[model samples]
Target: MQALQSLADNYNYFITIFLMVSGLYIVIARGNMIKKLIGLAMFQSSVYLLYLSPGKIVGGTAPVLDPAFTVYSNPLPHVLMLTAIVVGVATLALGLALTVRIYEAYGTVNEDQIFARDNKK
Candidate 1:
């Protein structure tokens, strides 16, 4: 029961871990370039969750001159996450564009198929 309660208490970490493993598995298990990109995006999402999950407070307020609020939430992680999201999107887009070019050249997006075709030549 204590373990279960502890697990519930840190469910966010578990979720992040799950996404990370799932993403990694997808990336390794699949041969398609697009699927690998999707997995990379998932892994990036897990990292974002890892940073943002701890930085948020349920009822925390921003730092201000007023004396009423004692707890202030840090805004740095959220800002960083926004930037990371933009960069991740750009990376994904570039990866997809490259995949398109690879398909055009090799007539397939599967890495194994491309390698086989290369070996034939």
Candidate 2:
């Protein structure tokens, strides 16, 4: 069927969408700080995939000055994705570090427990 073929052709887009939704759901549904960080990382990874997907050409080679190659994949998106990945890593590290500090201070990573403790104090 046409719809099936289209879905097959755009499977990567489906995967990206699935990851984005699942990551957002995890972030919103979980109470543990570490789980939320994991979800955030998943969300970031989906973004990387989204950025990199369109720059790919089926038969294109890397951007190089070669007369034999008529088509070359765009390198700009890949470069930007690399920078994004680096920033994402830094952000994940900082988030984890903060989670560690919070756990040390509060003795638990559950949001509700932390809020309850704060309310009691």
Candidate 3:
């Protein structure tokens, strides 16, 4: 009962782990280029969530050098996540562009089909 209660209290951690695993599974199990990209995006999102989860503090104010403010939420995690998001977006765009090029060259985005065709030639 205690374990169950603790699990329920820490639901966000479970959700983050689930998303990470599912994303990895999708990337590994799917052969289609678009699906793989979607999985990569999911994986990236999980990381974003993981980073943001701990940085948030209820009733915490910004880190201002003020005597009135005693509790300040750490801004570093949010800043890092913002940069990570930008990098993730750029990576996703590049991946999509490469997938488009691959589709244009092969007329198919399926990994197995591409490999089979390559083997024949």
Ranked by TM-score, the better of candidates 1 and 3 is 1
| 6: Cα error in model 2, Å | 1.0
TM-score (all chains, Cα) for each model: 0.92, 0.96, 0.91
Model 2: pairs clashing at backbone N, Cα or C within 3 Å? none
RMSD per candidate (Å) reads 1.5, 0.9, 1.5
Ten-residue region with minimum lDDT total, candidate 3: 56-65
Which has the higher lDDT value, candidate number 1 or candidate number 2?
Answer: 2
Q: Write the per-residue lDDT of candidate 1 for residues 34-95, one digit (tens) a residue.
A: 99999999999999999898888878887565789878777889889999999999999999
RMSD of candidate 1 to true structure, Å: 1.5
The CA-based lDDT of model 1 is what?
Answer: 0.94
lDDT of each: 0.94, 0.94, 0.91
Clashes of each: 0, 0, 0
Please give, for residues 18-37, the per-residue lDDT of candidate 3 as tens digits: 88989899999999989999
**Best by TM-score, which number?**
2
Looking at model 2, report the run of 10 residues with the lowest lDDT sum.
49-58
* Residue 114 in candidate 3, Cα distance off native in Å: 0.4
Give the clashing pairs for model 1.
none
Candidate 1 similarity to native, TM-score: 0.92
